[model samples]
Target: MSKLDSSMRCHAPVPLAASHDRNARRTLWVVILTAVMMVGEIVAGYITGSMALLADGFHMATHAGALGVTAAAYAYAKHHAESGRYSFGTGKVGDLAGFTSALILGLVAIGIGVESVVRLVHPEKVDFGDATFVAVLGLIVNIVSAILLSGDHNHGPGGDHGHAHADHDHDHAQAHGHAHHGHHHAHGHDNNMRSAYIHVLADALTSVLAIGALLAGRYLGWVWLDPAMGVVGALVIAHWSHGLLRDTAGILLDRSDAQLAGRLSAAIEGAGDVTITDLHVWPIGAGCHAAIVTVASTPILSAEVIRTRAVGIKGIRHLTIECAGPA
Candidate 1:
């Protein structure tokens, strides 16, 4: 048999688990603090009878729900530290959690929009003094929450830095080859937060809009504008929700392989140390993916060889390589 390709040499092992845990912990704290604040906002809105405050409260609830998922992800990761059921560990649990949260957020957006529209049709006289006070309080809360989330390293689309950071015995070069696997977790969480952020922003905007509407309705007697503001807020949130749902559904269904194709192919071609022909890739779960490659080389390269070479390419794990026709 032909000798193993010299270019197929191994590199230092990467630390994926430890890093992953750190991020999970960070996310847990962020979500926990935000959830607590969300509950408070909901109660405040009810007591004050402020539409804008209620709207902001609704947005906070979604964030709290999303954060709950983030906490679950952290728990799963901690529990399943090393299980054969997950070939790549439970790193992608974060992504799955985020995706679920996104879907929930989208539904919440739709519900809020519908209710806002109804209230618009039958406008209520809002206590501007009370509503304004509550709205301002909500704005401060959201800003502080956002600031806390941003200060952490895990608040990104990539695991840590730009991919999943986990403690594994795998070689650094090998893990680098599949860096794409790490991104799903980050991407999912980012979507969840983004949905929450949009909701909060909309809340803030609605308050400002309501101020104008309230003044016109109370003084100028332009009642129609109040409902118009509601309609506008509903429309804006609905649009944001649609995008979040589409993206999350795509992730849940494992439909984001196209974007992964080019990157994996390039990594394999560079690392495989062999001429590449046909390379196919698909996501298996969050922060994990599988690939199949057909290469033209002197002899057939084993799956292990290709996998070792492809490890560090970003988002790749559990790779399969096959030898094609004569070189």
Candidate 2:
């Protein structure tokens, strides 16, 4: 018996995201805005001789650097998308960037916690007027940055919404689901963009907290509130960082979804007398999933027949099927 393999269903590899170019552009713009804000804050802090302003300026610089990394990731992924160097394209690049940013965010939380502890032990004199002004300015800039980074996050962080399937059979014998060839991602979540946006949100939150703490300490003599707010901000940032880390790490490691795996198995085995002997499912990119499956049947089924069974399911974009006769 002759064998025909249609290993690649797509003429070209699927894109990492539907909004790949748009998200990359948005990330670059945000990085520029953050850099500008960092410079302005540092210069103003020096002239005003306010330690709080200087601290925040330095903090902003770190996030600016992280956002710079995010921009670089996007650029690298886009330029090499069709280079054929990556076996699965550059979809996981965004996941890697998100993971790195999350680690940086975690360190920031620890640093804030330590500084707050020191401040609590040895309280600093209040230069409320200068500090408050800087906080307000930083907050405004953060808001603008947030808006620039914002997009449609309707798909949620998991990047799995009602995505259309991308199916292919090498031979012309299989004609069903041809309309679903291209990976159409209406709401593919860009992890890199989300990480950068979170940074802006964290900064804005800290600025708001700092303003309130400064006002209370200056007017009511509750100086302890300043450090207290820092602790609170640190905790909040840490929580966000942890969640981002968990999600990105899962994608990076290609964590399997048992429920999805089970469903796919049922779809194939129920098609005829086939039984799934081996199955693997993981996220490749674009809020899509790719699967490699091996099956055994009494008379041996064709790969296309098995693939056709699994088509039309949500989030499953790519599939490879192997058929072994005589289960």
Candidate 3:
């Protein structure tokens, strides 16, 4: 859509509260189920004497733990929907949790990779039967959990809180004669789903690899393959985590580090009767952003207009425009 059309005033915030109760409850249940499965897999790994299975189990444990964080964040956001402390209370919590989880995953990946390599060097006896059974079971669990979070996977991360209309100085025509078009976020569950999906997908993949290696080693006596596969799995996880962490951390710190800052500055200057004396743009949370512009002019750009222009600039969620000239 044209920037002008999309930049129109946000009619209201997304509606997230109604689904809060059900969504939170669902997240909580997933957390519990994951925890249970983690334990089960670990025990099975020991019985089967499969290092790969044990590693996969531990990975599942990490995912379960991550889900716990997701659940907690969701609950906090839901309970504090009306809190004045947050202009948008706890909405970004999921982003924070997802970012943190991704970082953790990377670390886990590195550790697993290193251990797997070591084992490969010193080939060990692994019972293929035990490991294979457990790996299959773990895969099943991952699939089920993935299905549970299907809704989240499809929607953008944000909550369905009511909408708000900021005051504006200009007399602009609405899209449909006073009607505006904008997207509403249901809740931040997408992050939760993303995190969950990552875990399950990785687990399923590593588990399959582990089963293959175990079979090959048992049948062909290629013991080194077991550890080799482990290292591969670890490296994959590490790489994935690195990207996730970097993105999340960027948002958390509200980094203004971008090549587009200059362009955005000029755009703000052109948007209204103002000389863009200064501008600061930074991310507030994942997919949400904020910018501050300093200007001097009669009937200078109102906060709403600034917001409109800023939104037109990608990644801007909230905006504050300061009029420094004569009123």
Candidate 4:
């Protein structure tokens, strides 16, 4: 009987530095723009005694803060990509940032909901003229910021390599006894960027609701609409926050992607008379995954053979295979 054991580390096929730079730059610009708008709204609200304007301004401040975190995370990840301290590199830095931002988003949602409820219970006099102008302005700013951040989401460090197999010469690499590095594969979404985009979108949504409420109250005397819209916005924000949290948390917890794992399992078992005893898969960066697999096979089958069979599975950049055979 013979046993073959092999371990391979595959770097993500796409270059991350450029993507990181792009995201960081975009986030920074948005932060600056958001901060300026936030301050303006706050100052104008105070000057004009418009509670709606003040509240929206405060909301914008939170958006700026969340975006600032995104920018910082991108910069940190880019700067530390080559640092040996990160076992899987700094790819997941964005995920961490995303997680934090999600928490902030959830809090913001709660705050909005709570404030809306309070206002609904105790309706206040809103300066429609000033508040409406600020709300419209805020909406415009949010729209512009969203556009700025709307670059190709796929063109980042976490760019997907779903087609990594198409260009991969796996057999050739095996024959040459060289490990594959930086082979492209389809990647999943960049959670960090998504989180940032969500923040901007959420803010934009609130601005729209605020505008509608202010308009309705000004003309139709539907003052309750303002708080009602806030409640709706909060619910929307909460929903997005929950989704981001779930995804980022799954990655941080090393949850396996079921679909990818299923594909990997099928690929391995199809190659030979092998039974997979154990398998573990987790994302290490955007659009990249690492896996460890244990297989039991006939005496004639070697680990190299199994490894060859598992090649071309997209997004799997690192693999460790252990093969056991009858003695």
Candidate 5:
């Protein structure tokens, strides 16, 4: 067992993400925009006696806070990458931020649902004129915020922080002691940016719905439609929150994607007399994975030889090989 241990441990460079700085800057700008609009709406709502404006202003406050979480996560991950605090670095910070954002979104949905149900039972005299004006303003702000947060995808065909670019992949044998063979393409969505974008999208959706409900209440005398729309919007928002929650939770829990594992295995075991005794693979960052494999071979192949054949699975940024020979 001691002879099998090569005393060589290698890890991939931790991610700051391909678009981390750009996305962080954009999210910060959105936080500023949301905070400013939130204050403006709250002040105007009190002056104009518009409950719709007041509620939307508070909603924007939550979004600002959520986006702040995203920005902080990026900063922390970048700054602490070499701090050695996390076993796999702080790349997972974004997943935690996304998970927190989803929980906040769920709370917002629950609040809206409860308020809508209450309003439906005991209808209040809404200031339709003022509400319509605020709703329009909210829509404009949301559209701008959405434009700022949208399309922050990292199009780089490598793992986060430059894991397997074509030029870089050629040096894995010298660098990591294990040469990855055929695959150098690894990409994952920037989930932190995605969470922030979803917040803006959710706001835009609710604003549009509010405008429709306000118009119906103001002109068509269908005041009930206002609360009805709130209920519907809450349900839709909850669904979005649930999806984000599920994805982030899976990443945080280190749940391996089975499809990814199968692809990785096919590449490693496709040739040679290698049979894996144990394999563990899990995501360490957005589009990057860390794998530990224990293998048995009749001729007792070197770990390096096995890795030379295992290189084709795209997202495996880090690998640890333990060779079990005949004793």
Candidate 6:
């Protein structure tokens, strides 16, 4: 039996703690700012006896809560990155947070939809002066929050440093008769951050709608437009929430990327005459994937040769290749 008889494990390097910490601190700041604004809105709403102000205030509160979740998740993931309990580290913690936040967003949308429907059925007198001011304030806050959260910062589950080096090592080892394969997958931005950003944007959208509704009602006497705008904002929020849910849920469920799988199969088959008996590919972190390939190939086609050929494929950071009997 060749040295390749044993199963090979190639796991990608975990994301850096510094990146997670940076994002966590950013989210923490947002949470604090949002909470303070939420309290102010709620208090002012109560004093003014404006349902619009009160509703916007409560909406701000939900965003604060969701941002809190994002902050906590980043902190936890950073703290536990090296823990042995998590087989693949704690990279998925952010995804879990994103999933939960998305659920909250969906609930908020539903609540807005319901309230808007009720208001549409029976219009009420809106305190345009007070509500418009508060709505404008909320919009400014949301815009500021969005700016704070938005940027080209790469705070995702995978880091770029050392990825090329790692892949090179596999290439060097293959030359020395060692079988190894490593591919770095490029993952999208942090979903948790995206969720947080979307929350602020959604709030901002509501604020805009509120302002428009109030203005029209105050000057143009189109009171019904207020609730109608609410419905539109709710639909937008719900759409965003649904997408977030789908993405995070797919990650949590270990759903395979079909394109990635196809690339892997092609790489392996292109190497030599081999029949893939079984293959499993799953996401282990934000943009990192681990794969297991079982193949039946000619006895002369060593596992090292197969692995060497597949190493060029991107986004497969970790791989295990099992070679069985000859075809």
Per-candidate clashes come to 37, 0, 15, 7, 3, 1
Q: For model 1, how does the per-residue alpha-carbon lDDT over 232-265 read when each residue is reduced to its tens digit? A: 7667656665665665566556674766667666
Clashing residue pairs, backbone N/CA/C < 3 A, model 6: 185-315
Once superposed on the true structure, which residue ranges of model 1 sit more than 4 Å away at CA? 1-59, 152-222, 263-278, 284-289, 296-318, 324-327
| 10 residues in a row with least lDDT, candidate 1 | 166-175
Order of candidate numbers by lDDT, starting with the best: 2, 4, 5, 6, 3, 1
Q: What TM-score should be assigned to candidate 5?
A: 0.88
lDDT of each: 0.55, 0.78, 0.61, 0.76, 0.74, 0.74
Candidate 6 residues lying further than 4 Å off, grouped into runs, are 1-13, 16-19, 153-187
Better of 1 and 3 by lDDT: 3
Q: Give lDDT tens digits, candidate 4, residues 1-327.
A: 232225433433333433567778888999999999989888987897778678778878888898999999998887877776776677788889999999999999999899899999999888888777877888888889888888865532223433233122222212222255454533456778888889988888887998888899999999999999999999999999998898889888998888888998999998558888888878777777777777776653555677777776776766766666542
| Index of the highest-TM-score prediction | 2
Which should have the higher TM-score, number 1 or number 4?
Answer: 4
Error of 1 at 303 (Å): 5.7
lDDT string, candidate 5, 76-143, tens digits: 88788777567667778988998999999999999989999999999999888777887788789888
Which residue runs of candidate 5 sit more than 4 Å off their true CA positions? 1-12, 153-186
Candidate 4 error regions (>4 Å) = 1-18, 46-50, 153-178
Write model 2 residue lDDT over 206-237, tens digit each, in one string: 99999999999988989999999999999999
- Candidate 2, residue 175: the lDDT equals 26
Stretches of model 3 off by over 4 angstroms after superposition:
1-26, 42-59, 152-190, 257-267, 271-273, 298-317
As for model 5, its CA RMSD to the true structure in angstroms is: 4.4
Clashes of 1: 37
lDDT for 29 (candidate 6): 82
Candidate 4: Cα lDDT at 76: 84
In model 5, what lDDT does residue 265 have? 72
lDDT of 3 by residue, 1-327 (tens): 112223434323323433455556776777888888888778876896777568667877777887788788777766765576665445566668878778778777877787787776766667777777777787787677666765534322222212222212222222211223354443322454456556666676677788788788879988888788888888777766765666556656667835546756766667556676766766433344445566666654344555565455544444455555443
